[model samples]
Structure formats: structure tokens, C-alpha cells
Target chain A: MSVDARIARGGVLVLWAIFFGVLWETGASARYLGSRTQWIVPFGTVVLALAALVYAYGYLRARRGGPALTLREASGLFALLVPLAAVLLVPHAALGSFAASRKGNGLHFLSAGQSAPSKPSDASFLDIRMAEGDTAFAAQAGIKPGLRVHLLGFVSGSSDVPRGTVEIARFYIACCVADAQPVGVPVDAGRTFAKDTWLDVTGSLERRGRRFVVKGERIVAAKEPSQPYLSFRT
Target chain B: MERAGVAAPTVPSFLRLRRAWETGVVSETVFGRLLGGFVLLVVVASALRLGHGPAAQTFLLVFTSIVIEALPFILVGALASAAIAVFLPERALDSLARLPLALQIPGAALSGVAFPVCECGSVPVARRLIARGVHPGAGIAFMLSSPVLNPIVLASTWVAYGGHARGAEMVAGRASLGLVAACAAGLAIGRRTRASDLLRARPGERAEAHDHEQGDRATAFSTHLVSDFLFMGKFIVLGAGLSALVQASVPESALSTLGGAPVMSSLALMLVAFVLSLCSEADAFIAASFTSFSSGAQLAFLVFGPIADLKLSVLYGATFRRWFLLRLLAVTVPLIVIGTLIFEAVT
Candidate 1:
């Protein structure tokens, strides 16, 4: 498939522009791409339009018997498109598994004084605290016991806690995933839960040596929150 | 003659043995050579009384992650070059070259802001531009600046350093210095080297060859891209594995000790950057990890890396002639050092 060099180039530019526009609109905030506020979308759109103009030029030139798309030409276009498609797929795959896996493991721990509605009798609460030497929670002791505290975090991979008892775990991100640290407090809730479950728990925090155990609370498993991760205070 | 023929007929086993060695099917030499280095490493590790199990596990993890991640990206770069070879217009670059020198350098640099191509991808493209009549100086400038000046790099830097005043200041300082250095080197190279002296077009081409040369270049570009990708892929993996291994094997105390000495700390971080060959987008995170290093030293790491690191040097050497690359390094390295010194002086 022999394409006019001009046409192939134009097509590539157009495709790239559309991809960049979509990325920008969707809040893809990479430095080279655009900011999170969708400013790049219009810029990308303009590039795409210009590319269309160039493609039109190539098309007109070709119509005068300029050039035909050869097998090699088509393959090259396909090769370029395949990567573009794969790039598009990355966010979907990342969000799907990452969001689901981090569902309920208390990924976010609200500081002390955050209010929570009353909990149902059957469920128990766990007050999660950073381990000693961890600077993430040093400034604020999150959610004290006996106070109605609301917690949002994901369920981490399960761990066996002291014979026949299992505890759900979640990692809190103070920044990017590189700085993520796991926090696990014992949950006396009767049922075992799957890993990465996003949940909201209402309970009282019990302090246990840098960790807060939430006792007697309500657990509500739900969709992962928009902000799946958190950053450490600068 | 009859006696000699009879004797040879009875030696089938010997013939088989000879054939096996010739084909490397049964050569103990080859097997021994393959395992010799690994065995030596094991022996050394055992003698050191280190925890071999954890060390081995860490090495394996690092090796796989580095190699696997780098392979696809290098391939992407190679393919992009091939596409450029096959499809880009012949006179397109000439028209670009007609622009003023001042405009050309920044134009080339800004071109990358939109493309989002990594450092590996820039080498062949730069080569192609030079081949197509873009000034060698401008081409080199683009190659150096594109990796760091692009939107993705800027955004990542902002993201990584946004929270702190020091981080923000560092990014701004590096950007200012890096751009100035790239432009200065480019203009210097542009003025010094004749275009014909710097690059050789594809073989079987005339001084003013047109159609046939284009066709040959297209094929050569594809070949170059594929071969370059495969070759660099191995090294990228090796570098990454070595970095991961070092991270796992050497304790942080080693870095801390070096960190205590100002000059030693700067050189050590620079060495780390060279060894890691990390993508510019990711280097900031690694730099930040060295919380022990002073800001001036960290600035050196960021500046020296994008210009003269291992993988990029290899790419530059491969794409441009060794003489040209050496000259480029001579100019770039000292400039970076001066930039670093100036940055330190000011901040």
C-alpha cells in the first residue's frame, strides 16, 4: 500500500492531535501534553484541523494520480495506530484494576475532629494510625476512639491477625504510588472481605501504639473515590 | 592409498565429535564460558558472607523490570524512525533550514514539546534532520533540549517539585540553564562544521542525488531503527538491572557517607545518574530520593544527565560519527559544569 508521503504524514499528525486532544480533555496532565484543566484540548483540536488541511492537500495531489497506498505504507500506518490505541488503553486498565483493588482498605484517613454519623450495632470500627517513625500522621492524630469518626480507605490484601481473625489492609498514598505505605488496624467485623475494597466506615478510634483501632462500627463498601490517592503534606 | 582410505572409513565416532564441536553443539568451552562470570559472582558473594538469597532475588527482579520496560520503548523509537524514513517528504527539512539560525534552534526545540518523543527517539530524528539539510548545530540542540524541554518533562518536574519552594526553584534554574547551554552549543556547532563534512547520505548517492537516494534512505532508516532498538534494548535492561541491584545490595549508609562530603556527594550523584540512565520524566523522583544530597549537587545530576548520560551518549555516538560526538561532549560537558557552578554560586 503505497501512500503519498505527504498524505501519510498528514494522517499521522491528525491522529496524534486527536489523541492529544482527548488526553488533554480527560485531564491527562503530563508536562508535554497539557495541564489537568483541559487547556490542551483546543490546542490539540487546532493541530488536528491543520493536519486535516494538509491531508486534504495530499488527497487532492493524489487524485491527480499522485500516489497510491502500498502494502508497506498501510502497515506503517497500522503500526503507528496500534501504539496509539495501546496508549489509550493504559488509563482504562490502570483505573479498572487499581481502583477496584484499592476499594476499601482505608486508603484515606481523615484527621481527628472529622465527624461521623452513628454506626449500626453489628459493625466494628478500626482507627488506623501510621506506625512510629512514619511522618505522614505525625502532625495530626486521626479520629480518636469513642468519637463518631468517618473513614475512607481501600481494602488491602487480607492478613491473618492472631489466630482465626483476619484483618483487611489498605495503603495510604502521601504522594505518588512510590511513597505509598500500608496501614492495617484490626477489624473485629465478623465477615472476611476481599482485597482492594473501597469502603466508608463509621466508628470510634481506639489508640493502640501509633495505630488506632476502630471498634463497633458500620462498614459500607462502595465505588472507589475520584481521588484514589493522597499526598503527604509538603 | 587403499590403506589410508580403509583407516578413514573406520573413524565415524571421531568425525561425530569433530562435527559437534564445530557446530557448538557439544563444546564444553562454550558452556564454561557462558557460566564462568555468573559462577565467579556467586563465589565472591559467598566469600563476602552476604545474604545471598535476598540479594539474588533482588537482582532478578531488577533485571526483569528494567529489561522489559526498556525494550518496548526502544522499539517504539526505532519504529518511529522507520516511519520517518519511509514517509517524510524530502524537501520538508530544507524549507525548515531556510529559516534564520536563531529561529531554527528554538523551533527545533519547541517541535519536541508537541511530539512527546523520548530521548531515544530524538537521536535518529536528529540524524534525519541533518541528512535533510537542517543545520548540524540546530539538530544537536534539538536532540539535547527535546528530552527535557517538552511538555511531559515540564509537567512531571512540576508535579514532583511543585509542593516545595526549593523544588520549584530548582526546576526553573535547570530549565533556564539547560536551554541556554543547548542553544549555545548548537550555534557553535552550526558555525564550525560544514554540512557535507558532518554527515554521509546513504550509499550509491550522488553529491546532489535526489530520487534514488531518498529510496535508499527510507530502507536504511528502517534497518537502522530496528537494529538500534534491539541493541539499545539490551543495554537499557542491563543499566536498569544494575541500578535496581545496587539499590537493593548497597545500603543507604553508603550513600549517606558520601553525602557528608560536598564534592564527593556531587560526583557520586552524577555517577548514579549516569549509571541509572533513567528517562528524564522519571529522573526527578530519583533525584528527590537522594534527600541527603544538597540542592546544588542535585542540580548537577539533573543538568549533566540529559546532556551526557550513558544511554544518550551511546545513541549519539551511533547516530553521529564518533568525532562529532566527542566534540559535542567536549563542548556540552564543560558548559554543564559551568552551569552547575553558576547555579551553585547564585543559589
Candidate 2:
């Protein structure tokens, strides 16, 4: 390729590096890769930037009167640039109830080694997946017939559970959205709420047969959290 | 040539190289056609108003996720490929190639442990090895095995399944199956194939084709790094798009019924591995979550995924001829199937 062409191509590469690096720095990468893999953005962006710089230097000495890249090669480079549009033009987003519904069977987000959330009253961290932490915290106060706790999650599930209940759900992810699975708890608040509505519910846990049902003392609307997926180490 | 900090392509030779490139290269309007198709797609999507919710949301989610996840690994691979071009001596590569095919293939496969890269990162390195006169089969072996045998991947596999009943056994199975399949494929290809038959001449490669043969390490390295990044990066975009489409549309749970039988579950998980295209480092966690599948089937997912995935197939297209990839799949798929079944019988 000509010097001008090479320089132009190198410039494009630098722009891509900047776009992704900015995405990572601004935390947009978390939407695509799980929060744990954010480290890749920083490390990867730097490598790309360095390669671009080297490419840019070559363009200076390259004479202006040179043959252009074959059409095939130019197109290949252009296709590489397509992701830039995907990043900048297409909207930035995080996976949510829409994704959950597509997953068929709801995801089980708990880590293989993670014990079911311990009781919150024990002053230990509860699993954030599926509102396990809140339920565990409430259970510690009592995993009895009438144990009350505060809970927050996006509403999920269908008619099977019971009336006056919502499935408080969250995706638990170890790596990326591709591996994300839905995990949720059955909450019986005695009032119906729209599906996928983010809610803060003050509820009590009751043990009925093998199921631990949360009956709500209060329920109100809430906003989706900044980071939607509850992350686990892969 | 007097080298000073790896000078860029000079004027006259660049022209000469461009002319050489035109000579057997088929001319076509591929990129322009692709652009037309894309514009048409946007128009159709807009007309249908399909950009509104879940379906569009899911498509973008999966598409961008694959792009984001795989891009960095490709960068790492390009850098390693550059290093090989700049620093790895041709003599060293030649000596390794001099060994018996059996020894060379397995040795290359075993050496993957120290490489620490996933499948995306390994492809360019393998291509570079082939360009440097290493046997095509050995290069292919390294490409296939490094992602599976790399220490981090192995550790992740162990950790993902460590809590299960046959955790250690699963890890061992993945490692052994990976090695056998890779080496076996390598030898099969090496026994009679020629470079012209296996490798394709990608556009923009001609510039480095000169510096590569000469010992002009600096320029050669930089040229290759740029060439590889651009070539591999485009295919990555294509592969990621294909993978995302599968992820957005397909409900994996639908296949849960296929989980009941031994060979069926193996084939089923193999299909999952192809589409999901999870990084080898993280696939184990997903495989482990398949509590319903037999341990052997889970092993099949872990073994087959790193070698052949929707993403890797696109990359193989970029780096090799079409038939080579088809042959590769033919050999690899059956080996994983039989290997996993044997583990099922024994364990």
C-alpha cells in the first residue's frame, strides 16, 4: 500500500484502539464482557495502540508514489473496521430480562464451589445471585415460618409459583454474557407486580414443605442497577 | 540492506511487490458487495421495525460480546506472531522440523503448555511457524493444542469442576483428548501434504513475504504484526457475528432432551461448544453447569470446543484453504467423539 494509505489504515487502527480503551475506561466493556474480564480492555488496548504507533512510523518513510493494497486486502482491513461502527453507532447496552427469557430454563448463576448464601444475621456475605444474599440475610434473622427481610431484584418467572408473588431474579456470570445463566428466588408478596419490574421488597421468609417462600411486607419500584450481572470468578 | 530501526517499505520495491500481488490474485468485488448487503439489511431491519426490543437487544448483546471478548486475544496473538518473526531464529525452527514427523508433531503439541494463549492467539503463531519452514502438520498441532494445554486454561478447567465427583478425572480427560486429537491430526496432514495445498496467500502478505525470507528482523516483524492484525481482525468480526446470531436465536435448553444418551450427549455438547464459542479458559464453568449431562459428554464439550468453534472456523478460513479446514473438522470431530466415549466406558 502507498504511504498515505498505510498511514490512513494505521490511523484507523489507532481509532479502534482508542474507542475500545475509552469503552473500558468508561466501563462500557462491562456490558459485553463480565466485569471480571475488564482487565482485558486496558491490556489489550495498549498493545493495539503500540502496534498502531509502529505502523504510523513506517508511513513517514514510505514514498507517496506506491501501489495500493489489492482490493481483497483493502476490504479485509475495512471489515476489521466494522466493529468500530458496531461500538459507536449501535447502542451500548447490558443484558437483562430479554436475555433471561431467551435462555429457556432460567440460569443458575452460583459458582460451583459457592455454598448457598449464609444467613445475613451471621454478618457474612451472601450470594448476590438470585437475591440469595438478601434471602440469606433474612433467613439468619430466622429461616422459620415467618421471617422478614429486605430484598431487591428484577421481577421474573410466570404463573406457576402462586398469586401475590414475583420471581426475584439476576444473571450470575463467570466469564461473559455467552455463559450467563438466570438465577432467581420465589417471592410471595401477596400483591402482583409487572414482570421485569425492578423492585425493592420488604419480605419475610417462610419454610413451606421444601420451598423457602418470601412473603413481602412492602413492595415499591426501583431502577436497574448500574452493573446488572452478579459476577463470579471463572 | 543496512537496517536502521526497521525501516518501512521503500518506494520501488513496494511497487514491485504490488505488481507481484496482482499476478495470480483473483479479482472480485467482495467488499463492495458486502457493503451493499449491509445497507440492505439495515433498511430491512428498519422497515420491519425489528430494532426495538428483545430480539435486537439480544442480537447486539451477543454480537458485541463476542467481538469484545475475542479482540484482545487476537491482539495478543499478533504480538506473539511479531515476536516470532523478529526474534525466533529460522535455524531453531529448522532443527525442530528435522525430527521425525511423529516426534515433531507431539513435541509441538506438548510445547503448547508453555505458550499460555487461547485458540485465537495460537492461530497466527502457527501460521508464522509454517511460513518459517516448520512442518504444516506441526504448526497445526500447536494451533489446536495450545488453547487446551495452556496452563491457565488447564487450571480454570480444574477449578470449574473441582467441586464435582470426578473433577480431577475430567481435567485429565481434557488434556489427554486434546493432545491425542491434535497430534493425530498433525501427523495425518504431515504424512503427505504440501504447503501450496494447505496454505493460502492472503492479500497484503506480499510485503512481508520478502522481509520474511531475508533476516531483516525488524521490518519483517512490524510488517507481519500489522498484516496479521488486519487479516485476523476482520475474520474475528465475521466469526463473532455468526456466533452471536446463534447465541441470540437458539435456546440451548431445547437440546436438554438429547442429554439422556451417551453418544447423543457427546454430540449434543459438541454442538453447544461450536456455537457458544466460549473462550477455552472459561468454557469449563459452563460445561460444569451441565449437571444433567454425563461426565464424558461434558468432557466432549471441553475437548472439542477449543479445537473447533464457529469462531475458529472463520479464522481457519482466513488462514488456510477451505478443504484443509473441512478435513480438519472431519478428523477432529470423530476423534473427540470416540475419545470421550472411551472415557465414558472406562471411568
Candidate 3:
């Protein structure tokens, strides 16, 4: 490739570096990578920057004449550039009701008959999900029928949810959002809420048939948490 | 002097710059303009459309997350590849080549126990190894097994299943099957083909092939690094988009329909594993979530997923010959089925 084309490719690399740098600077990488942001974002930025520098130095020393840039080369660069640009330009987002419907809730683990960690009343959604599955965890946390708990989540309209109730859901992300599993319990709020509306529900856990439902006492409007998804670690 | 007067012709600076771009001297300006226009267009379009629904919202979230998570590993793979290209001595290559195929393939497959990188980070390193004169079978084995056998992945698998009564069996089944698939595919696919036959040449690579070899070590290292990064990175991004689309549009119930039949369940979960394109380290938790499926089927999900997924398929396409995935599936699918079956029968 020509020196100029090579340099152009380098510019594309710099664009990616800038994206990572921005993610790191704004602490937005945690939203994507969860606990991994501490290392991956900064290290990725450095590798990309160094790679770009290598191209820049090559351009400075290069002679003007070489093969013209090929269509394949241009397409490769754009293929990398366009989607990331689209992501960068779009307003930040999180997994919501649509994702909850498609992915299903994390209740399947309840049937696995496994042990789980004990958590406090203010535990994350993942902890709550796991607690519901493990009898030992529930006992240790003093969780039982008619015990009131505070739950923070968005309203979901998944079809599996019973009528007259909305699934108050948060995603349990393992690694990243791609592996996010919606974990929720049905909240019988006596009224319908718009899907993906963030809500804080103070409710009592009640067993109905084989499943658990939360009987809502106080439901208040809430904002999405700064870290919207609940991760495996705190 | 008056009679001989002639006007001097001059070109405007913009026209001069355009001409320079046309001839490739200032071609970088064109790229800069293309990037700027594309970004502006996307920003405007997203502002209008991103708020319309959750599907687009989910797509953006999953797409960016996958890319962000995978990039660091891709960079690490590129760095390792560059090191192999620039610093791995001729003696090491020769020694690896001299090993017997019977020993080389299994040895390479087992070496994954030490490598902590997942699937995203193994492809380029394998490509570099093949290019640097390692046996094709060995290189393929290393690439295929590294993600599955890596300590982090194994530890995650153990953690995901450890609380259950059959946790040991699941872990053993996954590790055993993963090793079998890797070694089997390596021997089968890499049997008669040389590197020239198996590896796809990157665009512009053929023209400057010798130039890369002959350039200063630093130049060569960086060139290889950038080339591998960009080449593999774009395909990964595209694959992530497709995987995200599948994730958003396809309901989990669609696959759950086939969850009861033992054989069909394994196949369905394998298909799910392919579409999901999850990182190996985290895939076990997802796999363990399918409590209704047989343990064997879940093992297939674990083994087949890390070896081949939508994202890795795209990466493989860029790195290997067109038929490599086909060959890979032919060898691995049967092995996985047989392995899972045996695991079920025994356990």
C-alpha cells in the first residue's frame, strides 16, 4: 500500500484508540466490560496508540510511490470503522424489556438445585436471583414468605409474566452484555407500567404455585443505575 | 520580451490536493473525509432512530460490548503474533517442525493448558505459527484447543458447575471432549495441506510479501501487527453485529423447543452456542443455565462453542482458506457428538 494509504489506515487505528481512551476517561468502559474495564480499556488504548505510532513513523520515512489502495483494503477499514462510529454516535443504551423477552429470565437456575452465596437486603439483582434458587442462601439472608424487600429494576413485558403483573427485571451480565441474562420476579403492582420504565419496588416475597411473586407495597419511579447491569462480582 | 510573453499556468491548492489524492500521494485525506462524513451521517440517523425501539438499542449495546471485550484479546494476539514473526528464532521453528506428528499434534493441543487467552486471541497466533514454519497440524491444534483448555476457561467451568452433584463429570467431559476435538480436527484438516494451501493471504499481502520479510525488524513487526489487527478486527466486529442481531431477534424459546430429545437437544444447544458467540470463560455459566438439557448436551455447548462460534467463524474466514470452516465442522461436529454420547453413556 502507498504511504498515504498506510497512514490513513493508521488514522483509523487512532480513531479506535480514541474510542477506548474516551471509554476509559469517562469510566464508561465498565458499562460494557463490567469488572474487566480496569485492565482492558487502558491496555487496549495503549496497544492501538503504539500501533498507530508505528504507522506514522513508517509514513514519515516512506517514499511517495507505491501500489494504490485496493477496494478490499478500503472496505476492511470501513467495516471496522462504521459500526464503531455508529455505536459512538448513538446515545448510550442498556439491555431492556426487549432483551428480557428474547433472553428469558434467570429463573432456570432455580431448578438446577445448586448452592448460592448469601447476600444482604440491598444485594444486586444477580444475588437476588441466586438467592431465590438456593434454599441455604435464602435461609442465611433471612428471606422467607411475606418478608418485605426492596428491588430495583425496570419493568419488562415478557409474555411469560402473568397478567396483572409486570416482570421487574435487571440483566445479570457475565463478561459483557452479550452474555447478559435477565433476572427478575413478577411484581403484582395492581397497574400496568410501560416496558423498560425504571422502578423501585418495595414488596413482600410470596409463593404462588411453583414460582415466587413480589407483592408490591410501594412502587416509585427511578432512574437506571450508573451500572445498569448486575455483574457476578460486586 | 513583450512579443514573447506567455501566461503561466497554475493549479489551485485544492485541485492540487485532489490530484495528489487521485495519485495516492495524499490519499489519507480522502479516508479522513470518508470517516468524517460517515460519522456525521450515523450520528444524525441514530439521533432520529435509536429512540424508536429496544431492538436497535439492544443491537448497539451488544455490538459495542462484544467489540470492547474482544479488542484487548485481539491486540494481545496481534502482539504475540508480531513477537513470533520478529523474535522467534529459526532454531525454534526447526525444532517444532522436527517433532513427530503423533507427538506434535497432542503436544500442541495440551499446550493450551498454559495459554490463558480465549478463542478471539488464538487465531492470529496460530496463523503466525503456520507462517513461521510450524507444522500445519500443530498450529491448528494450538488454535483450536487454547480457548477450550486454557486455565481461566477451565476454572470458570469448574466454578459454574462446582456446586452441583455432577460438577466433576461436567468439567471432565468438557476438557476431554475439547482436547479430542482439537487434536482430531488438526490431524484431519491439516493432513495433506501446506500453509500455502490452508492460509488465506491478506489483501495487499502478496504484493509486499518479500518487502515485509526484508524490512527492518521493527518495521516488519509493526506491519504484521497492524495488518493482523485490522484484518481480524473488522471481521470480528461484523460477526458481533450479526450475533447481536440474532440475540435480539431470536427468542430463547425457539431453541428450547428441541431441548427434550437427547440428540436433538445437543444439536440445538450447539446451534445456540454458535449463534451466541460467547467468550469461553463466561460461556459455562450460560451453559449451566440450561438445566433441562442433558449434561452431555451442555458439554457439547461448552466444547463446540469455544472451538467455533459466529464471531470466530468470521475471524477464521479472514485467516484461513474458504473451505477451512467446512473442514473444521466436518471433523469437530462428529467428534463432539461422539464425545458427548460417550460422556452420557459413561456418566
Candidate 4:
């Protein structure tokens, strides 16, 4: 490849760093990195930008005359950019049923020091999904039994649909999309919604046997959130 | 070849302009046009196709995540490799290499504390270390241990598994197992191997070694860093794509029951490690999420991954003889299996 082409490749990498940095800065990176790891994208942007500058400078100043690029070399460079461009071009998306199912996403076990509750309180499906375990999920996370539950998620693949229940589920990530685990609220919507449709459900968390289920007041179609996964910490 | 005497068919004006731009002094002009057009086409096509299905969407999201996560670490690795190339004192390196293999192997593995480079970085440095006259054993051990034993990887493991009852145990298991495998592999594979036999110079490096020798230090460092980053980044992108494909297509149900079988579970996770090629710094989190698997299985994933994977195999192959991988794997896999079982029994 030409010296200019080599330098341009460096510039392209720098741009990618900037592209992902903007995503992280603007909250788009939450779809992939969890709360704890989101910092990497921005840092990568800075480091890569600097590296690109150094590279461009060094290559420009070097006095070596190299041979012309072979077809294989040019093609190899193009191949590296294919997936990168594909990822950045498409709008950001959340982990869906297919990804969730692939990771075997499910309710996580409780961490230490989070105790079981003897009584339910005011909470929503979001609270339960983020909670430590089934016990913590059942106890209203400050939510009373018949309050508005604002919930947003796509229908999960493993969610059992019946005459009146809607399982609005979202994946919870610990690091990145690969480890995203599905956490859903089984909502009694009193009607049926097709799977994989993003929805905004206004419901109330209610105790049912050993689980906390949502009894919906109203369910409306909603757009996919800019950041879809619930991070482990937040 | 076309008859030289035959006048080349009169090329179209536009085609001539394109060819001229491609070979012209300002070659970047053609590259910019082609890149911009390609990006536009891809953007439009991906946007149209992204929402087509959950599977496609899932694949994209996972693929992007893997790419974003691995790129930075690889860049860091490149930088570290550059430091070794540009800044490491030849005499110091020689002194270290002169130590007996018994001390050199473990010492190299332990030196990861001083340089926290990741696996991507480790391969290039290992190749350099061997090429620069370090004992092949020491270089191999350093390569094996640096990615796993480094504080970055260890800390990530602590964070990932910290909440579990066996978190500390798992971390310990991963470190000890990794160190053992690395040192053992170093001694086992590189003990008497010729340095020339242990490494193959990179095509660019072999060609440019004479030029770089005359080049200024700053230019050399920057050049090495950039070239190493670009070179390693190629395999990373491909590896990330392959890993995402595996994550999207593999059925989770298949491994659900295998977690109970310690032997099978360890092997299953080893396979996952080989395929995913997840960076060491981030892999602990993924391994931690495998809740059904025993600690032993998880430990195996952590231990085996940084040392060997599809990407590392390809990356290592570029710098070493073809036998390097088979040799590394032969000694490393059994140790991981046995280590996992021991860890299971102890924990």
C-alpha cells in the first residue's frame, strides 16, 4: 500500500476510537459495556487518537522507500474495516431474545448482605429485575401493590405467554453483550403482545406465590432505548 | 502478458483518472474516495438489514461489543511491544536471558508484574524476545504469563468473581494455574529448541530491520507501535467476528447440563475459551457469568484462554513456527484440566 494509504488506515482507526468514544460519552456504550467498564471506550479514544498522530508523523518523516502494495496487502486492510463499518453504520440496538437465549440469560442469584423481606412495598418490574434474587425481587423495592409500574423491554424468547401475561424482559450485563443475562417482569397485561416487540408498560408489582409479577394498568408500544442493558451495579 | 507492442486499449477518461489517482503522489485521494463510498454503502445496507431479525440484531450487537472491548487492549499490547522494541536495554535483556532456565522461566513469568501487557501484546513481544537472543524458554514463559498474571487481568478477575462465595478461591486458582501452565510450557517446549527454530521474523520487520536500525529512536518506537497495532488488530477483528458468531448461534441448552460434570465442564469451557478469544481483562466477567459451571470449569476458561485461542493461534503462527501452537497446547491443556480438578477438590 502507498504511504498515504498506510497513514489513512491510522486515521481510520483514530476515527473509530472517536466514534466509540462519542457513543460512550452519549450513553450509547451502555448497550455493550456495563456501568463499571464503560470508561474503557473514552480512554481508548484518547489513546488511539494519540497513537494515530504519532504513527502518521513517524511514517511521514521516515526516509525508507518501500515497494508497491500487493493485492493481498490491500485486500487484507479492506477486510479489517468491513465489520467495523458495519457496526458503526447501524443504529445502536439492545440485546434481544436471541442473544439472551444464547447466553441463557435469566434471573441472577442474590449477592451477599441483601436480605429477604417479610413484607412487600412499592416497586416496579425494573426493580425486581435489578434486584439480587427471587426473594429480593418479590419484596416491593419501595413499590406498593397497586401503583403505576413504568417498564420498558422487548418480549423475551423464554417468556411464557398466556391469555393475560406479558413478559417484558431486558438483558442485564456485567461486562459486555456476551455476558448479558435476561431479567424480565411477567406482566399481567390482560391482553397479548407479540414476542420481540419493545413495549412500555405501566403496571404495579404484586406478590404472586413466590414471585413478584406486574399487573398492568396500560401497555403502549415504545421505541428501543438508546441504552438497553441493565448494568450489574446500577 | 499482453503484447508490449500492442497499444493498450484506449482506457476511458474516468478509468484513467482513477488509475492515475491510485498511483499518483497523493495516493490518499483514491483511498479516501473508495473508503467514503464503501462506508456509505455499508451504512445504508446495515441500517436496512439491522432490524431484520433478532438473530441479526443480536449478532451485530455482540460483534460490536467484542470488537470495541478487544481493540483497546490490543492497542495497549502494541504499545508495550513497542516499548520492548525501542526502550528495553539490550544488555539488561541479555543479562536476564543468561540466567539458568530454572530461574529464567519462572522469572519471566513473574516479570508480568513489571509489564502488564495483554495477550495480543504478549505474542509480538515474545517473538521479539526470542529474536533478540533471550532464551526461547524464557520468552515463551513471559508470553504465556504476562497476559494472565498481570495486575489488570487479576484485578478484573477479582471484580468479576468477587461477589461469589468462591471468588477469592477462583482468583487464586486462575493465577496459580496460569503461572504453572506458562512456566511449564516454557520449559517444556522451548528448553532446547534453537532460537532460530523458535521464531520467524515478521515480513515487514525482516525487510525494514536495516532501515529501522538507521531510523531515529522516536520514529522507530512510533513506527513499531503503529505497525504492531495494525498487524495485531487484523486478527482481533476477525477473531471478534468469529466469537460473536459462536455466541449468537450456539444453543445454550447444550451446555446447561454439562456443568455438573467437572471433566466435561472444564473441557466445554476450554472450547469456549478457544473460540471466543475474549481478552484476558474482560474474560473473567464472562467466565463469572457461567453460574451453573463449577469453579473448576470457570478457572479452566481463565487459565487456558490467554495462553491459547483461535486468534492467538493465528497471531502466534505469524511470528513462530507452526509447531509452536501444538507444542504449547499439548503441555498446557492437561495442566488446565488437572488444575481445575484440583481446584474443585480444594475449593
**lDDT value for candidate 2?**
0.73
Q: What tens digits encode model 3's per-residue C-alpha lDDT throughout B1-347?
A: 57776778888999876655444432456655766887788778777775347888887788888888887788889889988988889898899899999999999999988888889989999998999898899999999999999988887777777545576677788888999899999999996889999998766565345445665566666667877788889989988988988988898768666666777888888999999999998888788888778889999999999889999998888899999999999999988988888999999
lDDT string, candidate 3, A1-234, tens digits: 133456657767898999889888888876677563357789888988887887677556554444566445766778887657656655467778888888846754443334333545554455555665576767776666777778899987766656667888888766788878888778889998998899999988777654467889999989998878765542
TM-score of each: 0.51, 0.85, 0.90, 0.85
Candidate 1 residues B30-128, lDDT tens each? 334534654465456556643334344334433333332333345555556555555667677668878988898877766666656557656666766
What lDDT does each candidate get?
0.51, 0.73, 0.79, 0.72
lDDT of 1 at A198: 68
Best by DockQ: 3
lDDT of 1 by residue, A66-157 (tens): 22333333333443443243343233211222322222233223321112223322222322333222344323443334545555655554
What TM-score does candidate 3 get on C-alpha atoms? 0.90
Poorly placed runs, candidate 3 (over 4 Å): A1-3, A36-38, A54-68, A108-120, A131-133, A161-163, B1-33, B50-52, B163-165, B206-212
Off by over 4 Å in 1: A1-234, B1-52, B188-191, B194-228, B234-265, B323-329, B344-347
Q: Arrange candidates by lDDT, highest first: which order?
A: 3, 2, 4, 1
On the 0 to 100 scale, the lDDT of residue B332 in model 4 is 92
Ranking by DockQ: 3, 4, 2, 1
Which whole-number lDDT from 0 to 100 does residue A67 have in model 2? 34
TM-score chain B for all models: 0.69, 0.84, 0.89, 0.83
Candidate 2, residues A21-54: lDDT per residue as tens digits? 8876787777767766777788778887888877
Q: Poorest 10 consecutive residues of model 3 chain B by lDDT?
A: B19-28
Error of 1 at A90 (Å): 26
